[model samples]
Target: MALAYDDTNIFARILRGEIPCDKVAENDHALAFRDINPQAPVHVLVIPKGAYVSLDDFAANASDAEILSFTRLCAQVCTSEGVHLAGGHDGFRAIANAGPHGVQEVPHYHLHILGGRVMGPMLARKA
Candidate 1:
């Protein structure tokens, strides 16, 4: 299936400078910023500069440079936010929601880095 990217999405606007974001870290291929409606003490969103709709799309379509830069930026944010396991702080959770089942709010490919406290179960068990 062809991935549809909506340039008018909030992340796109932020990338285009049409909107402002509380930037945490940035590189040539990715931008990490604090989530406006944070779910945790350290809730940040990292988005690629490219136009991709979801994590699968990004993994399949993004260039090596884009992938590397984006991954590195995520690590950078974790360490800087004092949530990286290597930093001797509590670990972090990296989440990428996709499609309707995932309840993705934005149509752009973005990774959410959440930490600074226990995250509880990965997901509530469904009967």
Candidate 2:
């Protein structure tokens, strides 16, 4: 595989406005959009603005501000998606795909926030 992911690639295109997406939320550091093929009722992908191969790449290059933004965005998406929080009414899950073997289709760093209804156990615990 390439040393690093190319932004001009698919997910990056979506992030750059080269292609349209069901954008949920965005800031100077990150972007959130609905998953085209959602596994759960609410499946939003929160990705960084810059190009990074995967979660590892993001961790390596992300600044303190970027890291904070990513965490805040994740919480925001959970709220927007109605995921149970301190006083939230619904439930949600935050998922990040790491590498090829981990089922990462997109090369960009993103977190999939899924919710809207009760879901079964996580992949490891799924029947």
Candidate 3:
């Protein structure tokens, strides 16, 4: 039997075309779509095609080649999206949250590529 993974979640639905999304990029191994609740001027989420759950899950489930391809796609997206800037802290920030402690809203393993301006920390900072 095949390995188990929940494919009924929202992002998984988007991956399966059960839900429509503002698609930014896609490859055989991954798909990139815009964030519905964008935190930055350019906020896109990249997910592995067969992702069943969180990064922890994906990490455990995905093959080594899959992981490598994911990293390559991350670089590719950064390039294609014009997120790579010359100066430090001037480009996009790729984020993959593992679980609740990591602020992962969606269960699927997804990376938030946020850029287009100076970005702050993920958490609210005290004054």
Candidate 4:
């Protein structure tokens, strides 16, 4: 399905310099920043500099350089946040929500890197 990306989304605004973000790291194709409403002690968001509405959109459409930049930034954030296993930290969770079922709040593709504490089960058991 072709998802229509909303350029007016908050992340788009941030990228356009209309909104300020607590930036962690950035490259030509991607940007990593601290989430304003953090859910973990180490909460960083990695986003590609393209108009993608979801992870699948990014995966299928992004160029090799864009993909590499986004992936590298994610790893960079993990290590710098002290959550990378190689960095002697337990680990971190990378989450990308999509569509209505995924409860995606923004229309831009973004990865949430959460860590600094033991994250319990990936999700609550469906009752």
User: Which has the greatest lDDT?
Assistant: 1
Query: In model 1, which range of ten residues has the least summed lDDT?
Result: 1-10
Model 1 TM:
0.96
lDDT tens readout by residue for model 4, 31-125? 99999999999999999999999999999999999999999999889988999999467998999999888999898999999999988999989
For each candidate, give its TM-score against the true structure.
Answer: 0.96, 0.87, 0.81, 0.96
Predictions in order: lDDT:
0.94, 0.82, 0.78, 0.93
lDDT over C-alpha atoms for residue 63 of model 4: 96
Candidate 2 lDDT by residue in tens digits, 64-84: 889888878888888777785
Give the deviation of candidate 2 from the true structure as CA RMSD: 2.3
- What lDDT is reached at residue 32 by model 1? 98
lDDT of 4 at 119: 84
lDDT of 3 by residue, 1-127 (tens): 2324566789888877899999877877888888999998878888998765667677787988788777788777777777876444368887788665776666778889999887877679889
Stretches of model 2 off by over 4 angstroms after superposition: 1-3, 124-127
